[model samples]
Target: MGERLAGAEKEVLVEIVRFTQKNGLKGAEGGWKDFLARNDKKFGASVSDPKKRTKDVLLAFLVTFSKDFQKYFRKLVRRHAERRAIEQYMNEFSGRISPEQKLVQLTTEHLDYRKNYYFPSYQEGWKVMRIGKVSSSMNSGAMLAIDCEMVLCHDGTEAVVRVCVVDNKLEVKLDTLVNPLKAVADYRTHITGVSKKDLEGVTCSLVDIQKSLKKILAKGKILVGHSLYRDLYALKFDYSRVIDTAYIFKYANLPTTSTASLNSLCKSVCGYSVREDGEPHNCLKDAEAAMNLVTAKLKHGFNDPIEIAENSVPEPDQMKLLAHRIPVYLPCQELLKIFSGNPSIDEKIDSRIRGEFYSTCISFNDIDEADKAFDELDGQETKDSSGRLQKSVLLKRDNGDVAGFFVRKMVYGSRLSNSEVLKKRPQPTENTEQKKEDANGDNRKRQRTSKKHAKKAKAPVVE
Candidate 1:
């Protein structure tokens, strides 16, 4: 029994070693097989029982195979293989998830939602996501700030991208010239100082950059320079959790501020010295500046750390305008028009309609917070030209209150066209008489005050 066990153990080791040696033997491969054959007799009798001996031999065969071709196996199971598996899983899961389920997930997991985060309209509801505050002690989700610098290609139509990511420190994600499929006009000289020679051997397609960006975005949410709208417009990413420094600056109410020039903000908030280089744009540097701005705000007050003024209430006129544009939540129309030249209307409403309607109505107040909601709504109206729908709208304001109003499809189109009703009014609602009286009165008083100011400027009176 002892001899058999020793023989079996020796067989296993020999098989492992022989397998490891076979591939390395090159054209003169007889050395590995010859060595294995010489040792086989010693292990063949290691197991006395016929069945046990065959079983041991089989195991040894597998072990030998693995050891001999371990390099090939390792190559097959690299990161690329793992990524293929991940993509397959994502494709299957995406196909299985229903639209309702996607909506629920977006609301409960994907958004930057606080406990009482408001939604002003049903359309804006999609942007809502449940977000939990992360504690520093627990290292779980990490936020990354990314900036991409682009250059114009010689073809007058592509951009070279230099991407940087900021987690705690700055790191380069990608540095390459991307071929933007559009024309590269002379205006590109302002951003990318790339001459024709510089673009040689350094050009890649927008598709290549987009594929790379998709991989990068898949990893995490990226804070971008304030003008994220333009960047995202260029790249195809439903950019997740993007905190635009431009939007932040606007929300934080910083005057004479822009993300393009980082020096002013850096000096005020992060105390970092940054010098501009005339080389092709460095996106990584921009991403770092954006991250630093946010970090400073999170560490200190918005003003002291980010060099922005404290949050001040908007003027009354501005507040009134915001209140006007807040989305009115409405139920999904039962009969969605498909434009097949025939209308199929479903009059039998779902039993849950009332509950769903109420829930959506609650979100309308939340949509009111965004000042630019109207402009966005205009875009949506253009996209969804079904022209058969119900829109919850702010009613004519009377007695210092905006009432609820519902305009059917045809009515909305007419209302939109009527200059008298849709005129850009300075105030929400005022009688024509009141407007005329103010215009006449203020004009005379302003003219007299201007004359007096001019007279005073010409001759200084001695007191």
Candidate 2:
């Protein structure tokens, strides 16, 4: 935000300045205090020192003489933003000393294992070692892009077999094969290039590499990689600082929440790809590729290397049916009772997962059966153990406050089966009273027509 907060700062300040000019300082000050209170947890933690607001403070900011205060506010917002997003927070010039403002900064705090670690946090082996990835003393803007290759362990887990690290200058800092403590289940030689021969006399272990990485990543040094969290997990370090190129660049054609591959990003963003076709995975080239991607993004003024302004990514298109408004406590057997008499419904139901709500994909024999079931089920609420107004199944939620269960109709590409037991709805029969009324109406119309004809014949001829 240091470089990008130019127009955005004024865009926000204008609203405050205008509100103040319209309603005086009291309104502005009250609004400011309210905003600070609302975002205290998110923004307050970023500030190293806290201070109270004064009349002098407003005057200094409005008069543009508080350069120190302005810088502090910029850093505060930037630091807070770094926690919220990674795209704009990380930017760097290749082979040149990056300015403090443009450097990619990360929180000094350690990340919990719930996200990156494949196993549970309480597991004893989650952390590679007791040493933290970053310390308070190191505040350098340097980065080390890394890549790790893995092999299957006897315990049915992946272990790091090869590790590679490259500096911002594309210089290889460390590249070596490791002898995993566990017996190798599969060398995955075609990909990792580590065979039985590769580890023949390998002396270094993961612990040795961990000690070496502690020195390399120590002192607040930021790490860079493509999907670096996976590498961090393989290495078993909860490294706090990282700039992942997967989240930084855009291919524009992929899922919006998803990202492009390292090779794809490298080719599109840097006008070149590190690994060529038919080549096995190379960690050194991959590390260099990731660094090149970040520097390219930096060159483009922190914008995506390609034209991403079009927002050409299409929305997901698919039909989903569901029985909604059912409480979590509703058992699968009780819920199935609702679809009992409707022979249209298939017997398969998925109610295994439970939370605040419970629902299963109610498969119908055909589209007609599905539509018939939907008409009866939509907006019907399923009650809990206590008898209440809980009725039938549903598809969509009429209220934003409500949650809905989405049953995918076309799962994969399987076609819906035709049910031989389809029961056709009976046709409507004509009513006897309707027939009697039609005869009576015909007689009345005939009598009126006859009277009119007789009058015309007798009197209208003389005229």
**Candidate 2 on 348-414: residue-level lDDT in tens?**
3222223455444455445555445444543333322222122332322223232233222221111
| Model 2 error, position 261 (Å) | 0.8
Please give the clash total of every predicted structure, in order.
Answer: 19, 2
After TM-score superposition, what is the CA distance of residue 7 in candidate 1 from its true location, in Å?
74
Best by TM-score: 2
**Poorest lDDT segment (10 consecutive residues) of candidate 1:** 358-367
- Local lDDT at 346 for model 1: 28
Model 1 over residues 306-371: C-alpha lDDT tens digits? 332211121221211111122224222311211112222322222112321311111112223323
TM accuracy, model 1: 0.34
Which is the leading candidate under lDDT? 2
Q: Where is model 1 more than 4 Å wrong at Cα?
A: 1-140, 150-162, 181-183, 249-261, 276-281, 301-463
